[model samples]
Target: MADFAWSLGSPSLRLGVTGLSRAGKTVFITALIHNLTHGGRLPMFEPWRAGRLLGADIRPQLHPDVPTFDYRGHVRKLTDARVWPDSTRQISELRLTIAYESATFLGRSLGRGKLDLDIVDYPGEWLLDLPLLSKDYRAFSSETLERGREPRRTAIAADWLAHTSGVDPLGPADDEAAGRLHELFAAYLGAARGGSLALSMVPPGRFLMPGDLAGSPALTFAPLDLPESGEAPRDSLWALMESRFEAYKDVVVRPFFRTHFARLDRQVVLVDVLAALNGGREALVDLEMALGEILGCFRPGRSSWLGQVLTRRIDRILFAATKADHLHHASHDRLELILRRLTDRAIARASFSGAEVDVKALAAVRATREATVRRNGESLPCILGVPQEGELLDDHLYDGKEEIALFPGDLPDNPQALFRPPEAGEPGFDALRFLRFRPPPLEVTAEGVSLSLPHIRLDRALDFLIGDRLA
Candidate 1:
């Protein structure tokens, strides 16, 4: 018999599952926990595969709320139905413990250990904004301005852009003007959040709760005043901007960074690259810009004395292209190709600092495979998967057609593309085409786990985050 308490002597790993809105954070968390504890149908997730995973018992104390997160029921719902709508709300604090056999530590023989995984299932939208706390208002506005001009979008941003352009780019940081812009900016951001713009900067529900300072002046003012103006007045929007910027850094950014981002042993930056591609050329551009800007918050390229003053605690970063099950098996590489293009700037900027950077195409759920629909005998790259639930998920027929135009749900209408493709191969892929994903089995084996990995990536993520404490 395994020494349950003795195995408890090992350190528990703290994992934060973050991704863009609709990027599958909840489903992933649910599937991960369900598979880990119940050994239900799930993709192979290493440690779990070694089979020595003693039967896991999930108690309310470890996980606290169970009804709020009916993981098994959610999986059943998605798999049973022919179609599963995307997740719309944010659910928080779902924890699960997995007991498994681990390789011996140093001279010790192999024995069982418990992975007390505490998972935070947040809206990917809010998680993506973690990097935004670093930027000042002026810089934020400047970046937002560029993103507002993408060709393939139509929304509040268009109107906001008009207002921003009319505001003298070189004018003083007038407080009233800045306040108006702030409201407009917040509205635009809220709209973007609601619209499905995949930009990493938009905070989840921030659109819903503009906070107590909703009608207040905008913070973080970079003077649009000419360089010749020298210094603007202290009471100007510039000062309000400065104050808010400081507050954001101290009040908002600092605590999150210290408690979560800083404390994390590893990170998974889930990018919806396929969704961006499906949104077409404009979506691609916006995705790149947002990703680059977000990554910039962590890298700190050239040290300002202030830059030296503030630093993020995240040491290792994993940029993953989520929803891999949406693509045909062959197109996985192509999906990665598109992801590389979107994140090239961010990756390059991050790699220089010696932080481990990896790009992966994955569907934590493993939804479907590429197949062809022969309605008119036209061969197209299509996705194939079973539609039944429980162990019957694969018992149904393969369905779906080539998505001519895919809506990335709520992304901004017009967004920027960060990188240009090196060259297009035989694949006549538009920026907006991608394979739709299917869910993984409720019960999976070690080999199943391996397929889910674009590489030994999860192990690497865990190692960086928790390996130091392994005994």
Candidate 2:
């Protein structure tokens, strides 16, 4: 079993980086490591600014079983190729050792201090599955089915719901029947995740992003409409799914919690709030619900026998609204406010005693620069960047070669404005034009050494997460 307790020797801190698909988890990790190792300008980071930080370098990852994060390859992809690195599909780890001088006189007299910072990268999809631990198969089925009937999901779920209508829960279990249902259900989940819908809370996370369990019996089970107040018949479809669900919890979810999540000392949840806003009210609400469920898994005061035996509680959590570069600097604080309001209920529900929770709007790899454009004799704040190939605006498709200044619409002054659905003829979040931008070109020094990736508020985020420890 992985050791949950930290050894007293050189201090080690495990920082978890997780977010849903396209939320920039991979880029965030890459930028964080690159900044520290390459001595990127992090004026807000106290240790670095105070001249206490000596040096930072990559070290051998502690976990042999988990794959090392491909930092070098990802760096090449971003700096050399000028394209974003691939999104995270599985759990990976990277170790960075920072040597620093202690601020305290007594500590400085003792000697230099070295801290091992272990960065754990994993899919946010898997975090959604943590709620499964508290729910039975029947509850899972009923809840999933109810959500599928929601207005935002109903259309995408039509084919799956239609297929489920013909499925008999009490009918004898058949491989063919189960396989067909699983396929349809997985398809619905995929559709819900695509485009402007960007729906969250799609559970049985493996259905959408099955890493290795693809085609396994554990993954083949889909939620079915079960009759109320009756036990599942032996050898029936319900029984088969229930068994597989339980097996999945035991074989997949439990191991992850015990081995990785429970050991983390700090965590960063990257959120693409712009995407959620672009997706409209339904998507925003869905993201809130999903975030709440994920936070519930980290409920504080875990003093149970198993909790005591398994892992320590995370002390710091940072929920970051990523891709802040998409908006003008003026809207960054507004974006942070929106995220804070979005997750307010979730933070309260978790009630993490002795833990500090914070939210910020940040871009780990800044893809745009601020500019002011005059339109109709009025100056407007804008962002200038190279839009990715095929990006569309005003019926014009970008060829990816020209630099353009876009006046992405402003965020509401009141965060609550995002919660309510728009009224008839009212302009909704659709007014905001968020285009995917390619990674910025890297700057090289006179000696040919490449500077670190540019970012917005990454230093403040790092300070909040690990500055105290470095001190």
Candidate 3:
């Protein structure tokens, strides 16, 4: 019914853009639309390369309730101020109308084809909440508690764990107690996501990123130590927590699944694979589990023209490892392979459901340009760019304006090596550095026209994502 209503209003292909925190969802959408609108170089995009892609324009979507993607403001910040756009916090929409000459002879005879591309930007953290639908409060609490007890999480989750240990599920309902537990639990989640530790299994995902539901009772509940094979008394704290958990799944997760996720014709899940690598084997394994849950939420399947008209199914899934600029071009393929390895199971699941799934390593906005420097009388591949202020590496702190060339470590050829425990003498993730870089300065033409944001493999990604639709 939802898809029918959506299709009745607009004949557009909806693309879901989502990623884990700091995976560059905002930049990808901004750069993609900017390149198409400004005619930025897109050789790998078939329609753009063949001169069949005429032009593109952003159109206001029919839904007034959905906030429009702030394309212009983001462009102003990137081009005029030379800074990255703020990360997305809430859901937003943008529709790009592309006028293109059709590739087929018969298609050309019919005249120019215009494809309305509806881009839906949402936080991947929300997608992490999907599994909550099937999980009861007891199960959810059990899983979250088990994760908190893990060795890696022991320190970060100490306060929450200690506090939760004292809370009884069958105790009298106390709003203050629930709120306190929520605070410590949320703190543990936030700390786990910090730079030094990149754990990803923090679910009730909205707890960490509570956009509008911050202090509401819907967000106040926390895990409690429950007795085995027990029932909660009607007026007990467990009952309140369970009711709120159900309310969260009802009020938050289900609506998103029905209204937005279920309507997507395609999806690209961006992963900050480098950060996961930095956190070592446990983080990598956690990421894999999170991805499995994420992949399972998607309704991926092959649809005939008639089938598509009747129901919306995501027919293509792109799992992109974002921030390719952090590594040199020499390791891009290795990076892609590593992501491919990480998501191999999820890809199989999607493929079995009849969706075309592919993976790539991409930097939506290329922050660094490549260079070669001689060190110890040997040429070494390095990337030249400005590191953000206060970023410390090798005992040198960047002032955010000074540009420097760096040999941002290479990804290993064997993707499996990343998952295995390091050998005594093995130069592992500890040996590498992944520093954040500011957005590159835009290229200006002689006439003072600014070109589109530079990128790596973005064109190819677009080609695989929407090329067939344009054709």
Candidate 4:
């Protein structure tokens, strides 16, 4: 009862937006802001559709310590330059103040409603480190080493593993050795993330996207081969590495959780499911495991100890498969189904008491339009757009200026087929003929008024994330 009063008196919500690299996090944020500020069409967002939403504008962020989200700069890049904004490399915050009319009779009698929507944007790579909070140095080392030895990862992990075999855990600490190990390990992680591997379990995320802590000792350490049950010798390499790992969790991971994550009221996890699908069964399963681990960090139920300490919980979590524009509308539902299946275990493990969970296929900035192409007397559903230059399809290279129609293949009717390993002489899963597309040119009126960014179901996402608050 007291909490309800507090919420009503001070209407504020912190929304956390996160996703792996190339998952459209930056574009999503920019499009969302542009649509709301410009009074764009949002039929699915009840607050906007019902005419209760009066206005929404950017205000100064509440936290002075954190850098402001570069809304203007990103808008310029997207609107003026017609190019996508760069991916988020660090933490940033933005506050959107919304004015609305009250829905209830009593509230309407009182006056207009207002809400401070604080949006926190951060790298999803950072969330990968949360599982490290409970893991000791030896446990982390053993798990990472085991993963490195997996068949799919062996090729990429060879250089790092070769170096690991030569280093003695109990030998004297050497800065050069540590640096070399860190570099090799970081390179392996980068390789796994690139192309079709799409591995998501890489930790000490600073190593991969080290913003300001590039060369710091806390980020220099890598997992080493150590005995199953033993203590590290005093001042030995193992001991030094262990200490730095703890420091990273203490100084880097914990602060992020305490300051930013703990305060979030809602969250949107963007995913590039198409990329994983293209990678094959291994990448899909790895992505699922990674998402499960990340979801476990959320304090879902009020009975949890972390929930008690934080005094707030993430009451709603929306797992969205981004870049839906790459596929035809006919496959959108299947895409959503795949995402739901991918997150099923994580959603169950979270067991968020009184929390709502949903999955959707959305394109923050739709880059394609629906079309039909005729081939062999059959009309095939296709998406027409300008593929980025050098994007190859069927031995043809796109020049970036030519509009082409692409028939992105269909997803399986039963998403369960995605989990099975491929049989001999068979492609693992139904691979989409996906290609990156340049942002669509904006529409403008004769009077020089530009329209809001076009999107696929973005308003529905807005409704799921914040519609209840406005009411």
Candidate RMSDs in Å, in order, are 8.6, 2.2, 3.1, 3.2
Per-model lDDT: 0.51, 0.88, 0.86, 0.86
Clashes in each model (backbone N, CA, C under 3 Å)? 41, 0, 0, 0
RMSD score of candidate 3 (Å): 3.1
Which has the better lDDT: candidate 2, or candidate 4? 2
Q: Which ten residues in a row have the lowest lDDT in candidate 1?
A: 405-414
Ranking 1 against 4 by lDDT, winner: 4
User: lDDT tens digits, residues 126-181, model 3?
Assistant: 98887687689989899999988989889999999988988888888889988999
Model 2 error, position 335 (Å): 0.5
**Model 4 lDDT per residue over 263-282, tens place:** 88999999999999988888
Q: List the residue pairs that clash in candidate 2.
A: none
Sorted by TM-score (best first), the order is: 2, 3, 4, 1
lDDT of 4: 0.86
Clashing pairs in 4: none
**lDDT tens digits, residues 8-67, model 2?**
478899999988888899999999999998889999999999999898999888777788
10 residues in a row with least lDDT, candidate 4: 1-10
Clashing pairs in 3: none
**Candidate 3: which stretches are off by over 4 Å?**
1-10, 299-310, 349-351
